[model samples]
Every structure is written in structure tokens, then in C-alpha cells.
Target: MKIEIPYGDSSETVELADRNVEGVLYPNPVRSGDEQQVLRKAIENPINSPKLEEFLNGKKRILLIVNDATRPTPTARIMEIIYPLLKGKDFKILIATGAHRAPTEEEYDFIFGRLYQEIRDRIVVHDAKKSECISIGKTRHGTEMRLNKLVIESDAIIPIGSVEPHYFAGYTGGRKSFLPGVASYDTITANHRLAISQDAQALRLKGNPVAEEMEDAEALFLKLNIFSIMTVLDSNHKTYAAAAGNLRDSFQALIKKADEVFCVPIKRQAEIVVTVATEPTDIDLYQSQKALDNGKYALKDGGIIILVSACRSGIGSQTFLDLLGSEKSCKAVIEKLNREYKLGYHKAGKMAEIGLRSQMWAVTPLDPETIRKAHMRPFRSVSEALAEAFKEKGPDAKVIFIMDGGLTIPRLT
Candidate 1:
């Protein structure tokens, strides 16, 4: 059988024997609604809170928060829908950079789309390092809720985000735009440290300490007038569902919709798994590691998990590479991560944990040395990586191809 897996902008073809194929994991078949109608209805008829137009009634300065380029959130599309309401208001668009760097020129274009030229001056890129942050309070879990002051200064707040299965914190979007999205370095570092817990995993939120802390942090914003627009996109990035209204209500309301788009089931684990991270998530090793995290669940112990990404931007976080290289084993790497926990170390920890149980390999454009430093072997292409896996595991080895590992979570039935 021959299959083409996405890698960056292109796809890589890998051929395997009929007996060697386990199954190709793709997002479940879901009905995609009209994008405009989905956004319009969500903005008009909200969940628990009043409609968006009503929420913006008495507000003075409006602050629009959006995810960085890392997420597939259709912020520009949302902006287009709401710009008419914000026409006369004093609004500034803030990029929720979290601990990541500001978007590059091209990324800015990708983020703002056609409105870039018009709203260029109104845009404020979040700087976790230099941005002024105020303490909102502390989480019930004891993590401090210091965040960007812009959230407090602005009279009206609107956050546009997409919800999907997150390896940690259960899912991304909702309160996430507040925590790691617009949070201070210390706050983000403290919250993300909880990701080391076994309870922090995909499709779960009840006991996830990271998520709990995030919810706790957002609780402080209850006094403020907030209308959060959360969208659930199908596999094609078409808006299939959306919710608008109060913060927590809108976020929680979209969970079932998100599940419809990301959850995939398999009858059994496979000996080899190929997971590809595409486009923006494929920009670097740090972001692309998400594929490995999700694919790990479908891989047998000692099996090969090949991450296919371009990683053209190089190792995203030097701290990650340093941490992974500091220890000879993933166990040691985890020990160091727990001791000197940082914002990006959780990424390192997740990758290290997976490498502990499986053979980590990659077919990325990243330098071979860079790949090896992260405890993963580098292959020239998906075919090469698959050939290597077959050679080591044997001709009859079962393999699984995760079509969109960045967002797709493979579950065992």
C-alpha cells in the first residue's frame, strides 16, 4: 500500500506491504457546517452569556486576544465577523505569544490575513519576558496567576481560539488563551510544571492540574466583561462548530464539538507509528514534538515512532535541546526537568518520556546532529524511516500512520 503523509507544505510517499499495514488513523467523518453561518450564529446566540454585541455595549477599550501562529485558530476570520461591531471602539489586537517569540513578518501575514495592512498599528504582540504583568491572584493549586496587564487594563476582552486535543491540559483553547497564551513567564512556567503529572493528558480536564490551574486563573476574570469565541474546525480547517458567550461556558460547551473532530479509535497498538506534523506546527522540533506525544499512545513498547516534520526553523527552544542532551537517558532528563522546571521543559519532558519507551526517529529537514541530540534518529524521508522500521521489526511488522498527529488523538477501542 502507498500513502502520502503531510510534511510541512508537501507530502511524503511511503509504501508498505499489505500485511505490514495496521491502519491509517484519520479524523472521524464529521459534517462541516458553513463557516460564515457557524461564526455568525455563535456570535449572535451565545451559550450562557448575552450575545457578543450586547457584551460590547458599555465597554470602552476593547482587547482582542488571539493565539500565535502555532495554532490553527481562525482569528482573522473571527476578526472579519466582529470588525463591524468594533469599528468605532478603541480596540487593540494582542497576540497571545505566551513564552514563544513574536511572530515573524510572514507569520504576521498568516495571523492577520487581509486585515494586516489596516490593523497593523492596532496590533500588540505579547512579550512574556518584557511585557508588564499584574498579579490576578493565585490558583487553588498554589500557582501564582500573574499575567499580562493588558487583560486588566482593557475594559472589554474578546479571545478568539480553537479547541483541540492537547497532550497536556486535556485540550487547547478556552482558558488556555489566558494561561500559557497571555501569561507571564513565571506564571506559565508554574502552571506548565503540573504537566508532569500522569493525570494531565489528552481529552481529559477534570483532574488535570495544568487545566485546573488555568481554570482557576481565568476565574479571576469573572469581574471583567468578556466574550470568548471558541471555534471547532474540521480536519480541513473549516469551521464546523463554534460557541460564543461567557468564558468558561463557551469553552466547556465546545468540548463535545472538538471531540467530534479529533478523537480517532484503533483496535490495537502497532509495532511502528508514523506521525506527521504539518505547516506552522512543523516549523521547529519544539512544536512538532506534539505528533510524537499523540502517536505514543498507539505505539507498542520498543516500537519505532517516526515524527515527520520539516522543522525548517531549527530547534525551536534551545532550552529543550539542552535539557534533552544534558541527560544520557530520558529518566535522567525527567529528573532534571522536575528539578529545574521551566516553561519549555514540559515539551522536553513529554518527548523524553516517549523516547524512554519507544525508538524515536524522524524524517525531518532538521540537521541529523540536532535530531540525535533530542534522542531521535534522523532519516532522509518517510520511506527511508519506514524501511528502517520494517528492517528492524521484520517484514510482517504492523504499522500505523497518523494522518494529522498534531491534533488527532488515537485511542484504543
Candidate 2:
């Protein structure tokens, strides 16, 4: 069997005996509909809230919060739908970068598409570390809501984002465009600290402290009269579903859609799992680690999981790498994490936790030494990594390929 694993903008092919393959997992093939029409309808006929025109009435200043370059959100397509509606309006576009850096010229183009040139002057790249913020009380969990001043200045807030299965936050979008999206660095670290808890897991929001607190932070923005637009894209990145209106209501409407596309079910765990981080998620090791987290769901304990990512920009979070390199083993890394938790430490903790139970390896553009420092054996190619993994797991070891490891969360039946 020949499989094409996504690597950044391109893909790499790997061939294996058909019988040795368990099955290749891809995002569920969603039934299609006209996405542009759906989005326009969603905006005009919203859920549990007024329509876009109604929501815009009487509001002087509007703030549009959008995802940064890391996420595969259809921001440009969304802009196409609403740009005419927002034209000549008193509004400013803010890139919700969270703790990530400002978008490069290429990334800015990617985010706004053709609209970049038209609205470039009105765009504000949020600088979490340097931006002034105002505290909006604290969550019951004690996470402070230090939001960007841009959020408070606007009388109306519109958060445009995509919903997908997030590794730690159950799902991404809605209130997320507030907390970690445009929030202060310290505030983000406070909220992310809860990620160390096991309850903060994928596809679970009931007891997830991170998800709960993220929702709690939403109350702080209610005074701003938020009208949110959240989308769910299919395996091909085409918008499969769209919801608009009340922040929570719109998000709730899209969660099912997100699950339909991203939550996959498998027959059994494989002895060797090859997971590939798709596109923007493969931009860096830190972002690509989500693929590793999702990979474990399809892998057996003590199995070797090979991660395939381009990591073209290199290690994303230096703190995450430092934490992993500072410790001799994943166990020690977790111990260190427990002692002093930082913003990026959660990534290391999760990866380390996985390391305790399984073998981690990677096929990426990064040097072998950097991969070694993260406690993962490095390979120049997925086939080479799989060959070595199979050597240890045995020639008959069954392998599974997770086509979009960053987004597809697999569950065993």
C-alpha cells in the first residue's frame, strides 16, 4: 500500500505491505452544501441573537477578532462574505495572535487573502506582551481575564474563527477568540496553566477547566454586544458548516459540525502509528505536537509513533524545547513541569506524558539533535522512521496512518 502523508504544503509517499497496514484514518467525508450561501444565510438569520445588520445597529465602534497564522481558519473567505457589510463602518481588524508572533507579510496575505491590500491600513497585529490590557475580574479558577484594550474600546465585537477539535480545550473558537486569542501573555499563561490537568483534554468540555474558564471569560465581553461567526471545514478545508449569532450559541451549533468532520473512530490501536501534521499546523514543532497528542489515541502503549511534519520555521516555542531538553527523560520533564509551570510548559508536559507510555520519533526538516532534545528520535524520511520502528515492533507490526493528525481526533470502538 502506498500512502501520502501531508508534510507542510506538500506530501511524502510511503509504501508498506497491504496486510501490515491497519487502516488509514482521515477526517470524515462530510456531505457537501453551498458554503458561501450558507455563510451569508447564517449571517442574515442568526441563532439566539440578532442578525448582522441588527447587531450592527446603534454600535459605533466594532472590533473583529480573527485567528492568527497558526490555525487553518477560512478568515479570507469569511472576509469575502462580510467585507461588503462592514464597508464604510467604524471597525478595525485585530489578529488574535495570543502569544504567537505577528504575522509575516506572507502570513498576512494568507490571513486576509485579496482583502489584505484593501484593509491593510486598518489592521492591528496584537502584541500580547507589549499591548496594554485591562483586567476583567477573575474566573472561579483564578485565571485573570486581561483582554486587549481594543476589545474594550469597541462597542461591538465580532469574533470570526473556525471550530476544530483542540488538543487541550475540547474545541477551538467562540470564547477562545477572547481568552487566549487577544488576551495578555500573563493572562494566557494563567489560563493555559490549567492545561496540565488531565481533565483539560480533547473532545471533552464538561469538566475541562480550560474550556470552562474559557467560557467563563466570555461574560467579560457581553457588554460589547458580541456577534460571532464560527465555521467548520471539511477534510479538504472547504467550509462544511457555518454558524453565526450569540457567541456561545453559535459555537454550540458548530461543535457538532466540528465533531462530524474531525472525530474519527477506529477498530483498534496499532503497533506503529504514523501521524502527519497538516499545513499551517506543521509550521513549527510546537504546533505540530498536537499531531503527536492526537496520534497516541490510535497507538498502543509501548508502540512507536512516528510524527511527520515539515517544521519549516523550526521549533515554535523555545520554552517548550528548553523544558524537554533540560530533563533527561520525559518522567523528569513532567516532574519539572509540576514544580514550575510556564506558558509553553504544557506542550512539553503533554508530550512528556505521552513519552512515558510510548516511543516518540519524528520525520521533519529540523536537525537530528533538536529532535533528540525533545526526546524523539529523528529521521530524514517517514519511510526510514517506519522502517526503524517496524524493526523494533517486528516485521509484522500493524501500522496506522493518521492523515490529518493535527485535526483528526481518533477514538477506539
Candidate 3:
């Protein structure tokens, strides 16, 4: 069968093996009883009983932190089970949103769904950035991983998140809920920058020093006695497994399942890139720009890459729009930053190198000038971009197509 694939502002149709091998392996499939069973098992486990009831007994303040946006949000059901368990107890629930900024009502609606009102009324949502976070302590690595004062003040800290394959940290959830979701800005930036700088060539789990450092940071958080409750969600964002004992042991078990669901079908490499944009996560230019790293992996040093962002939602952040205002191209922007702001100049340089190293194009409804300022050639449509890419790369060039490049991580079966 022949399929047309988008590559860097253009598309190319390629012939595939006649074998009917499509969607054979599911990453994480949610069975009907999976979530409730996972929750029930965790509740029934004796080890979790003492602590769970302790929080329910209201002796010490309790904080529940959960992922705000990512798919398969177990928000409603998880809270439904938890709030009842801890009702009339001295406990509080707070949404742990990292530096991604707090969500508005609509976003909150999307995040919490039907549970929005119930969760909102009973619990306080802590914005990691603006909230009164305190310097809990520093890791052995000297990274100051602060926490919300309320969380620090709590007798126990329980974090909830969906485990997924992260581009930098290998996986999300676990101690990530306490760090990026609730830690100070410095800690978040430091950890993120560390991951970005390490092994830029292969941004995978193996042999990456940043992932090790992050694990260390995670350990330090646990060593400080930050008890956590971690859950593993299948691709459907439904709970497949839940662990509720010691923070590390519990998280490790869930991490194992997360690895099974998240890190599947590893790929050696690819030559062409295709990316689809999803928002809030892909809201603004800067946020969406992060997705380019995946394309870097898709390319063969000088391969063509295509981005498809309807982005009708408009540029979402003020800072990003301000930066784009004066810069003509990514390279020019970096040079200008070096000559002017001098701050984050290295990041700008690295970003420019990443952008310029690959032949890139975009198909979006965004203004042509805005696309040009991004240092990308704009195409009229997905088909036009694919056609152009095919013309540019030649009919016989090896091509790779990725749907939703920002969120989808490809693995070989």
C-alpha cells in the first residue's frame, strides 16, 4: 500500500509492505474494570491502610497533587474515590501544575470534567509559580527543589499523575509531581536545562546523564520523606496500576508498568519528519517550539521536516509573542540575543542550531510573516507541503512520517 507522508512543509507518498500489520500492538489499553480495580486494590492493600486512614482521620493535613492537562486524566474518578475516603478528614487536594501556568475555567473544565465543581469547591489549587512555595531544601546536587508551603506543612504529601514517556526525563509522574508540578521555578528550570543539554545527539532513555541526575533529584525528594501515591495510566489515561506504599517502592512498581505502556516499539532512526500540533501544551510559539526536538530525532542530520499546526487558537503567550515581534528568523533572533539581551544566549544559540541544521517547513493558517519570522517556509496546506517536500527531497529519498509529532513517540515493533 502507498501512503502519502508529510515531510517538512511537503508530502510524499511512499509504498509500504503489502502485509496487513497495522495497530497490532497497543501501548496501553484500558479495560472496563482496570481503573476501578486498580483503585480498589490500592485501597484494599493493608500497607496503604494505616497512612490512608491517617489522612482520612484528619490528624495531619493532606495534599493531593495531580496532573492537570495530559490525557487519560483520572481526575474525577480518582477524586471520587479519594474524597469519599478522606471526607470529614483534615486533608486538602491541590492541582500540581508546573510552570505551564494555571488553567482558566475552560481549561479547568477540560481538566477536571464533571468533577471540576466538586474538586474546586473542596480543594485548593496551587499554582507552582505564583503560590507561596517555600525552600523545602536542596538536593545533594545543589539543586534547590522547593515545594508549596502548604505541601511542606502537610503531615503527608501524596502525588498523583499519569505516567508517560517524556522526551527528556524518560518518563513523567512519580516524583515529577512534587518537583516540576509543585517545586520552585529554579528547580524546574535547572532540571529542564540539564535534560536539554545532555546527549543532544540521542535524546532517549539510555546512557543519558540528565535522566540520571533527574533520578537523583527524585531520590532526594523522597529522602526528605515526601510520601507519594503514584498511578500508571494506559494510553487511554485510565488507571492500569496503582501503588500506595513507600514513595520509592510504590512509584517503582508503577514506573515499571508505565515503561511497558510508554516505552514501546523503539526506533533506530528516521530521515524525514512530520509533526501535528496539540494545544495548551502547544499553546504558544515557545511552548510549541519544544516539539521541534522530536523532529531533530526524525531527521538524518540534514533531512527535511514538516510541521502542521492549525494553531487557529492563536499564539498563546505574551512573552513568546514579544520575542517574535522583533526577530526576523530564528538564527537572526539568536544573534540579536547574543548581541543584546546576552541572557539565555546559549539557549538561543542551541535553539538556532537545532532549527538551522534541518531543512524545515510549516503548514499552518498562521500569518506568512509570522511563519517566516519563525525561520520556517510556510506552505498553503498539508498536501502542498507534502508535494513541495517530495520535490525537494526527490522521489526516491527515504522518508518518515509522524502524526502528532509533539505527543507521539514512535517505537519499532
Q: Best by lDDT, which number?
A: 2
C-alpha positional error of residue 80 in candidate 3 after TM-score superposition, expressed in Å:
1.7
Q: What is the C-alpha RMSD of each candidate to the true structure, in Å?
A: 1.1, 1.0, 5.0
Lowest summed lDDT across 10 adjacent residues in model 2 is found at: 215-224
Q: Whose TM-score is higher: candidate 1's or candidate 3's?
A: 1
Better of 1 and 2 by lDDT: 2
- Over 4 Å off, model 1: none
Residue range with the least summed lDDT across 10 consecutive positions in model 3:
17-26
- lDDT (10s digit) by residue, model 3, range 94-177: 777666656677777776668777657656666655788777566655777677787777766667666655665666666767
lDDT of each: 0.87, 0.90, 0.59
Residues 1-413 of candidate 2 have per-residue lDDT tens digits of 88887777777898999989998999999885887887888888889997888788878898899999898888998889888888988999999999998889999999999999999988998888999888878888887788899898888889999999999999998999988999999999999999999898999999999998887887766766799999999998888999999999899999988998998989999999999988888989999999999999999999999999998789999999999999999999999999998889999999998999999999999989999999999999888898898889898999989988999998887
List candidate 2 segments past 4 Å from native.
Answer: none
Q: Comparing 1 and 3 by lDDT, which wins?
A: 1
lDDT score at residue 210, model 3, on the 0-100 scale: 49
On a 0 to 100 scale, what is the lDDT of residue 61 in model 3? 71
